[model samples]
Target: MPLIRYRTGDLGRLLTEPCGCGSQFCRLDRVKGRIAFRSALPSVYDLEELLYGMDTVLDFSARKEENKLCIQVLLAEGGTIGPVREAIEARFPDALVSVSSTLCLVSTGKQLIN
Candidate 1:
């Protein structure tokens, strides 16, 4: 199927100027950003940055269970989930964050917000 005048959900600017090497193809500029990934929550990339930036987190999953937000994590160096849960709760005050084993519930293979 062909899509015409469609929003690709990508964040960038189209460059129509000819290339210095005489190429006629146009290109897009660096990512300006996209529309809000999820209306009720932050974007996946943002969450990834937040989690991955921490030292103790080896891997994680941001998911929901029993009508609340839960984060499952694999810790490194025998780290504790208490700090992680507290950090997340601090960021999302109203969210009910819980700790779970690495067995996370994933739908559509991405963070299930909203």
Candidate 2:
């Protein structure tokens, strides 16, 4: 096989440092966003990582409404809303986070936004 560079549209960092497990091979950091979603502002990939990092969030979608960001989330059973709202606020100071039982999905069944 020949070496080729392919664009996967994922945005992330490459780690050069050895891992705590003692592996020296470089590792790609968590994907931050897709190239198609690139913009002058913070990438939605970062926000997705933050929301999904929470144990309760089952799914989520985010959109810009006027001057504020609206985040709708689906929670796991017995999930609480406070933490999700806090995480989004902390990361995006100006955003308005809303917790919901359902979020719209595309035809492919993926969450509509990031």
Pairs that clash in candidate 1: none
For each candidate in turn, the TM-score is 0.50, 0.64
Q: For candidate 1, lDDT tens digit of each residue in 44-79?
A: 445556778889887665554544555566678778
lDDT of 2 by residue, 63-91 (tens): 66666666788999999989888887787
Count clashes in each candidate, considering only residues at least 3 apart in sequence or on different chains: 0, 1
Candidates' C-alpha lDDT: 0.56, 0.68
Model 1 misses residue 79 by how many Å?
0.4
Candidate 2: list runs displaced more than 4 Å.
Answer: 1-40
Error of 2 at 82 (Å): 0.7
